[model samples]
Target: MSKVVLITGASSGIGKSIAVFLVQKGYKVYGTSRSPKNIENYPFELIALNVLEIATIEKAIDFIIAKEGKLDVLVNNAGMGITGPVEDTPTVEMKAVFNTNFFGAIDVMKMVLPQMRKQKSGFIINVTSIAAYMGLPYRGLYSASKGALELVTEATSMEVKKFGIQVVAIAPGDFATNIAAGRYHTPVFENSAYKENYQLNLDVMDAHVDSGMHPDEMAKAVYSIINVTKPKIHYKVGDFMQKFSIVLKRVLPDRVYEKLLMNHYKM
Candidate 1:
């Protein structure tokens, strides 16, 4: 029998790419969206699930288990993006992004673990971001949110290993997707200290997304991870420089790396 998979935030972008690829590969895949009903003619079933809502998460999981008898893989991909200067961004907005990207991912993992534990075998892949590796200017909160998920992925992997559940994270660099359209961008305040530079970085950010690697590359990475019997705790999918940045961070001094990022963003 084919493996059953559940992927959150599958209505578009990387999640959608992964879901469609898996379906073509013979996996029974279910993708989730906040308003799945509105989406039409999707290759796989689109279920109603909003990461911010615990009740919806529970219901989606239950419905999947009831139908499939087991959920073999979970792609915890649901998330939101927030962009702004850390100081100028509202604290509430910061909390909100963390709520969806960090707490929300954790909640889905929590809900699925019991079932995964019962099965004695499962895989959980958290879709993080390359930005998670280092704090980027004007996107600090988004970085923090994904970075937290990366750490949690590490801890959860070790904790659940004995139960035959493997948890890991895949951080992707800028992927050509509609993420920029959905991201919550705090306005570049006219009177704020970061206005000019923030505006500049925002433009650069969107341009990167516009020219990003195809989402299919991320899908291929996810597919490879799923097939591994002893997958690594972390995986990264991106262009050479994007992947190399993580290495540079490890080798470079604090201020040196900070300067590199500042130069890249022209801050």
Candidate 2:
């Protein structure tokens, strides 16, 4: 029998691409989104799920369990991006992004983990970003959110290993998608000291993402992870510079790596 998979944020972008790819490869895949009606007709079933809502997440899981008899894998890919000067960013905006990016992913993991524990086997592939390890100038909230998820991913692996559960976080470098369109930007203050430089770097951020790698590459990475029994605890996909940045941070002194980041952003 084919494995059963549930992927969040499947309405579009990386999540949708992964879902479609898995379906073509014969996995029984269910993708989730706030508005499932728009993409429910796709090859994979699109379920209505507002990750911020616990009850909806429960319902989506119950729907899968009822039909599949057991949940085999979960892809916690639902998330939102926030961009702005950290000091100028509103608390409400930060909470909103955290609600979806951090809290939402945690909730779904909690819900699915029980079933995986009961069955004695399961896999969770978290869709994190290359920004998970470092904080970006105007994208601090987004960084913090993914960073939080990465911490959870690492800790959860050790916690769930006895139950035969595998938790892997894939840090994908920029993938050309609708992430910018869906992102929430904190308002820039008129007298803000960081306004001018913030705008410049923000535009650079947008252009960089606009020319990001294809989502198909990320989908394939996820596919490879799922097929393996002893996959690594962490995975990085996309540009060599971004992946190498992770390595550089480990080898270089704090000030040296920090300087490189500042130079990259022209801050």
Candidate 3:
């Protein structure tokens, strides 16, 4: 019997790539998106879903359960990025980021766990980012959101291990995806706090992401993990610099690591 996999944020980038790859591997892939029509003629079924919408999330899951009878894998890949100084970022904007990136994943997990428990087998992969481990200049909000997700995945993995469900996080370094272009930026008050460093931080973050790794690589990494018999709790995927960044942070002193990042961003 073919395994059924559900992936959120399937309209583009890594999600789209994974959906296509899984379909090719003979999995029954149900890819969810806010606008399924925009991704017409895809290999898998595209279900309309907006992760922030509770009703839509429930409906989408129910639809899949009715059609497939079992959900073997759930990839929580939907998220947004907010780039600006943390102090200057609006509370509303920060909430929006968490709503989609953190709470959205948690909601989906809660909805799917009952089914997975009954089935006695399933995998939940949360697509986090390298930012989860390291803070960037203007990406504090985005980083914090992903950081929260990392902790969630850590605990969820242990909680569900006895039930034969695997929960893992994939932290991909800078990926050349719509996320960078799709990032929301709000104006900071020139006279407000952190003004002196706000624009500088924003520019640095923009340049770094613009030159990040390609999304297809991240998709490939996701595909690899889904097949593992005992997948690691977390997998880091990115270019040399990203991998190095992780290592440097561990070995170097806090101030030294900060200096390296500052130099890398030319701040």
Candidate 4:
């Protein structure tokens, strides 16, 4: 039987790309959107879901189980981005991003893990970002949320490794997607001194995303991770320089790395 796969936030961006690519490659793919009326007519099945809502998450999982009989893979690709100076970002706004990006992903993993444990085999890949590892100006909240997911993936993998369930985090750099449209810019940042720099940073990020790597590359990475007998705990997918930057951060002095990051973003 073809492997059964479920991906959240599959309405657009990288999530949508993964769903389409997987289905073409013959995986039984189910993609999700929060609203029933807002989904595109995709080749794979669609499930309505709101990652922040536990009930909806459970329902989506149950629906998959009932239809597929078993779940083999889950890609927690559902997430939102918030951009602004952290100082001006409201507590509520920060929480809102975490609710969707981190907590919501955790809920899906918690819901799916039980069945994965029972079957003694499954793969859970959380779609994180390169920003999770680096400190990006104006995108601090987005970075922190994904960073939280990365740690969870690492810790959870250690716990579930004995059960034959693999948990992995795939951190992608900027990709050509519609993520910018959905990103929340902190409203409170308007009066801050950092406003000018914040706008410049936002503009830079937008340009990078507009001309970034294709989502198809991410789909291929996901496909490979699923097929592996022993998948890695983390996979960094993107430009060589972005991937190399992670290494540079590790080997370079803290002082030097900080300067490089500032220079890279023109901060």
- Largest lDDT belongs to which candidate? 1
Worst 10 residues of 2 by lDDT: 33-42
Candidate 1 lDDT, tens digit per residue, 1-267? 899999999999999999999999999999999998755678999999999999999999999999999999999999999999888999999999999999999999999999999999999999999999999888889999999999999999999999999999999999999999999999999999999999988899999999999999999999999999999989999999999999999999999999999898887
Model 4: per-residue Cα lDDT over 30-142, one tens digit each: 99899855445788888899998889999999999998889999999999989888888888999999999999999999999999998999999999999899777788889
Give lDDT per model, in order.
Answer: 0.95, 0.91, 0.88, 0.90
lDDT of 2: 0.91
Pairs clashing within candidate 1: none
Greater-TM-score candidate between 1 and 4: 1
Better of 1 and 3 by lDDT: 1
What are the root-mean-square deviations of the candidates from the true structure over C-alphas? 0.8, 1.1, 1.7, 1.4
| TM-score, structure 1 vs. true | 0.99
TM per candidate: 0.99, 0.97, 0.94, 0.96
Sort by lDDT, best first: what order?
1, 2, 4, 3
- Model 4 segments more than 4 A misplaced: 38-40, 188-190
Tens digits of per-residue lDDT for model 3, 32-66: 98878855579888999898888998999999999
Task: Supply candidate 4's per-residue lDDT for 251.
Answer: 96
